[model samples]
Target chain A: MLKKRIIPCLDVKNGRVVKGTNFVDIRDAGDPVDLAKHYDKAGADELVFLDITASHEKRDTMIEVVRQTARDVYIPFTVGGGIKSIDDMRAILRAGADKVSINTPAILNKELITKGAEIFGSQCIVVAIDAKAKGDGSYEAYINGGRVNTGIDVFSWAKEVEKLGAGEILLTSMDRDGTKDGYDLELTRQVSELVGIPVIASGGVGSLEHLYEGLVKGKASAALAASIFHYGTYSVAEAKRFLIDKGVKVRW
Target chain B: MIGIIDYGRGNMSSVEAALKKSGYKFVNTDDIGILATCDGYILPGVGAFKDGMEDLAKRGLDAFLKEVAKTDKPVLGICLGMQLLFDYGEEHGGAKGLGLIKGQVKKLTTSFKIPHMGWNSLELKRESSLLSGIVSGDDFYFVHSFKVVPDDDSVVVATCEYGEEIVAVVECGKIFGAQFHPEKSSDKGLKIINNFGKLVERC
Candidate 1:
């Protein structure tokens, strides 16, 4: 069976991992490369390094961090945040990143997705969507750290992006970010049903059960969490073991 | 020195890195002279069958490789490199392969996934120098949509279960092929490569 993936996302700022409490009150976790290697040893199926820093100095440092991590870790790794151009994608990929995730830039220029897919294979491109539920019971697209609302329907954007040649969708619910209440199942199901590519559910994985529920009920191919994993609340190996015991096929 | 055939596919760096880490002398090359002088050869690839075969043919390394294989120099193929040892591959319509192994590479019909990408336990089917340090149930990383169904079952060294008994490693005389990347698979992967290194050393 296609094994379910458990991923640890490291939010990198100024070449260091900055873990926040519910996406606020950020603190230094550790060196990004060291943390990535630790997770890779802990049997993380994949790792995502999001460069959250806006400074030029930090951007280059993050790229170097990714390069170092790729040298040590053999498993697949995805780098995201501020990937503005095809050159940026190439730089990250050439640095040994298997895949590049784009959010704000992809939204600003929809053709960027197609252009990226053309240069590098579609399998190397991941489109991450941050969706938040509206009062009218519709989900809206948010960009730039969930500060800017695109007002685009989540399902529509997902389908369009898939058509634009995205190999996978990294769907995160802003409303559920760091809540640990559970994954926003409705958003996951809606987007997953609309796209043919793999959907990685993100934003609100609290426990092993949440991981199971996200994959089983939410129909996500993989699940991503930040705080729980970064804070050592749940180790990836134990979570995978729990899921495997519950009949979820996970790669140990 | 072991020569890892570079046909512009993935797994080249990983193989080289693993070999270096294992304390083995190796070179990644497409040069025919280097391959001819090497103690043994390691063919590593990751992509479609037709594309891989085209790469070998374009470099004129295919004929050179066949000639080398005939000399009993011990050549190992990893992942797509393993599939290329067969007579044919069903990927991209159909394509001709190296014909070293009497088999046809066909797309996997397992219910697991299209691209079986992850670590899976191997079931050793037979004993060989390639299986020297590696044991049964040892997990290795695999990422492919097609698998080789060897015409000669005796050549199979190991098999793994996904939905069916898929060939994981095959050893026939001097030619050994592993459908998994031993380099990217950590310790077990390195062990498989190390065993190949030993085989070259013995030769």
Candidate 2:
């Protein structure tokens, strides 16, 4: 069987790794390239860099960040945030990122997903969904750093993107982010079952048991956490060992 | 110098970076003449099977690739590039491949997931130069929906389990194919590439 992936996400801002609480209160963690190498050594299945930079000049720096990270670390890496077009995807992939994640661009223009998949192949395109629960058994996709609600139902948008040829979905529970309570298992399980593509469950992981829950009960192909790994609460290798002991197969 | 074949698809930067890190000279070229001059070649690409074969055939690199396989010059195909080494594939309306390997590529019948993305441990089938330092249970990054179903089992160098017995690495004479991306698979991955470098150093 395919192994359940334990990914350490680096929320990068200004060439450094940073994380926030419920999408705010951002603070620095470490250098992206340094943190990337750390995670690689720690046995992370993959690494995700959410480039939170906003300036034009910094956009160039973010590309350099990807390049440095790719060179320093030898694992499948993904760069997201500020990616707007196929050309932007091209630059990141050229910088040596194995994949590129899109959220705002995907919500603003669903065609970006289709065009991206066409130009770069669906395997390299990841559609990130920050879904805020609507409290009516439905969730709305949020964009602009979880500040604006797209009003697009998460399930509908996920299915739409799959139809548009997205290879994977990075589904994060906005309400559960930074809670450390656990992943939104109900949401992840529902979404994972709804789509054929692999679903990466992001946001809200507090313990190795939580990782097991996410893989077993949440039904996610991969579990992505920021602070849990960044804060040294658990090394990815330790977490994988925990999962394996719990009868969850993982790549070690 | 190793020639990285540009089939008008996929990214070659990581492959070049890995080759450079391994201390081997490389040139990304579509010119078969330059390719013929190189010690060996690395075929790097990712995408649909039919589209990949079409691009290779369009540039006349399809026959050139087969010709290279005929010689002792090693050819390493990554991901979709690896799939194209087989006879044909069931992906994208059933396309014909280079027919270097005995079998055809078909969509994975595993009950697990599609694409099979993420890292998985390899089960080395037998000894080969490409797996010199690499051992069984070593993890490599894999991302693909279709896998080669070899008619002859002896070609398989390593197998990684993911529902069905997925072929991780295959070596038949001078041609080698990896379903995983060794370039992006961290240190263990580079070790595999380094072994290939040693194989090509003979030329």
Candidate 3:
């Protein structure tokens, strides 16, 4: 009985966490390591630090954050955003990140997925896809943090990455992001069904029921949320309890 | 002291952090002399079985580990490291293991998923020191595409159900192995690490 994962994603910039709404107990909410420790204590199955740093000069800050988090936090965590090359992936993983999530770079150079999986193993490479529903019962892969549309079909991209030896897929629905509506269940289910690897449903989870829907209805192996846990709307423990009561197996 | 064998595997920092948090003194080394000095050794790895075995062999750790298996010093293997304790593995074509235990590793043929990647509950089969203070149904983080099939059933300490009966923990004499990453399983995982640490002290 493999438990469905509950991952709390934190956006990091210049070594500090960004877009974090509230955490009264935490002395430094901006500190990515502190917030990561808080999530680990709160029983997050895993954590994801999306390094949104815009400058290459400050990118090394995320590595420091990963180093501190790995020393302090016990649960597995993934590092994404701004990761472009093999050296970038090696730096993060060597700093103790369990997995490295790549999106735009994977789209720009499909060889990154193949070479990364070959060098670091497939389990270490996670191909994150930001998908936007095209209103025609289809979704297109979006990159550059959802600003640039790759024009690649989401289903075709998902299959391609799997063939390229990706261990997991972090599928985010652009249309549903920040809407608090819910995950695009159709997008999640279609991709999860299209690939043999695990698919993590991300973007637009407003309630515990949405988490349930993402896992049960969306057929996702894991559900990733940010504001729901950060805004204090629902703790990871509470969501796990809700999902467990709803018959979803989650790590306690 | 526990020696964490480092042979260019995926990550050793997580294992080092867990051992430190568990209040144990350890050394990360591939040198057999240094590993021989430690009371117990932890073979921690994350990757393909063929590659992992090759890394161990490159550092002459495969023969050393086999010799350690004959002693009373407790040795624990995690994930791909656990798979290396078997006699053979069917990953990346096929590869020979250290033969520490009587078993063969095979790709998980479960209809559910390929990498069975997530936390899962353990079903205890028998008692062992490695599982001290841990009980049945306790969850551990697992990430792998294969499972070990022990030739002797008595070596299996616990099993987890993942579309089938998957071996989770195994113990034979002083050698133990877990398919899951105890270092990343949080509190309960720390308990297992502490148990192995205490076992080393007693040894």
Candidate 4:
């Protein structure tokens, strides 16, 4: 069976990770390259970089970060945030990113998904959705890191993105993000069951059991977490062992 | 030098970077003449099989690859490049492939999911120069919706199960292919690229 993936997302601002890591394993744990190397060694299936710094001037620095990370870390890492145009996607990809995740631009101009898939192939385009539960048994898609509401239905939007040529969907639940409670299983399962493509469950991953829930209960293809792994709450190898111990197949 | 064929698809730079990182000299070019001179050829691609095949034919690379196959001097394909090594593919309408390996690329009919993306463990079926020094069940990165089913299972170097067995690596004579992107698969994956480099060196 296809192994479930555990990806550690690094939030970057101005070519540097926004938060510093206090890991004893990594010499410079806060450094994106060093942190990525640590995760690679820890058995992370993949890594994702979100460019919180969307400034045009900072683009070069972001590219440099990607290049350096690519040189040091061999596992594929995705670059998200601030990627607006195909040229941006091409630049980062050339700089050595295996895939590019589009959230804001994909919602603003849905054609970007189809066009990007047409030009670079669907495998390279990952559509990320930040959704917050409506309390009315529905969820609304958000952009700008769950700040702005797009008023789009999450289920319908996921299907649209899949139809628009997106190879995978990164579904983040704003309701559970940073809460450390667990994934929004209802939302993840709801959206995942609707899309034919793979869905990566993100936000509020606080424990190994939570990741398993994201997979077994939420029906996510992969589970993505941030702080827990970043701050050394648990190593990726530990997460894999935990998952496999519970019958979830994970690549070690 | 290993010749990396530019079929107007696939991340040529990633493969180039992987080659450079592994301390191998390679030329990324589409010129059939240049490709023929190299000791080995890598058909790298990323796109629908129909478009890739059409582009290869348009650029006269189809004939070039066939000619190189006859020489049997280590020809390898990565991901979509690997799928294109077969007889035909059923993506975005059925399309003909290079026929270097007898098979058809069809959509993965697993109830699990499509695009079978991310990391998966290799279940080695047999030994091959491409997977040299790699253990039987090492992990490698994979991102694809369609998989190649070789007519002759003997060519299957390894298999990765995703609801069903997926052809992970294939080798027959000097021709080779990997459904996973070895370039993006980290150390073991790069070791596979290094193995190919050794194959080129042997050639």
Ranking by TM-score: 3, 2, 4, 1
When 3 and 4 are scored with DockQ, the better candidate is 3
Each model's fnat? Answer: 0.09, 0.69, 0.88, 0.73
lDDT of each: 0.83, 0.88, 0.90, 0.86
lDDT of model 4, residue B138: 86
lDDT of 2 by residue, B87-124 (tens): 98998689899989889898888877677888888898
- Lowest-lDDT window of 10 residues in candidate 3 chain A? A20-29
lDDT of 4 by residue, B1-203 (tens): 99999978856777887899899999998888887789998888888999999989988999988988898599889998999999999987798999999989999988877778878888898878788889877888898889999999999989988898888999988999999989888888889899999999987
TM-score per model over all chains: 0.85, 0.96, 0.97, 0.94
Q: Per-residue lDDT tens digits of candidate 4, residues A105-139?
A: 99999999999999998889999998988999999
Alpha carbon deviation, residue A79, candidate 1 (Å):
2.4
Clashes of each: 2, 2, 1, 1
Q: Which regions in candidate 2 have their CA more than 4 angstroms from the true location?
A: A55-57
Which TM-score value belongs to model 2?
A: 0.96
> Which candidate do you rate higher for TM-score, 1 or 2?
2
In candidate 2, which residue pairs get closer than 3 Å at backbone N, Cα or C atoms, i.e. clash? A1-B163, A74-B186
Show pairs that collide, candidate 4: B10-B46
Lowest summed lDDT over 10 consecutive residues: which window, candidate 2 chain A?
A52-61
Best by TM-score: 3
Candidate 1 lDDT by residue in tens digits, A209-249: 99998988898888898878888898888898899899987
Candidate order by decreasing lDDT: 3, 2, 4, 1
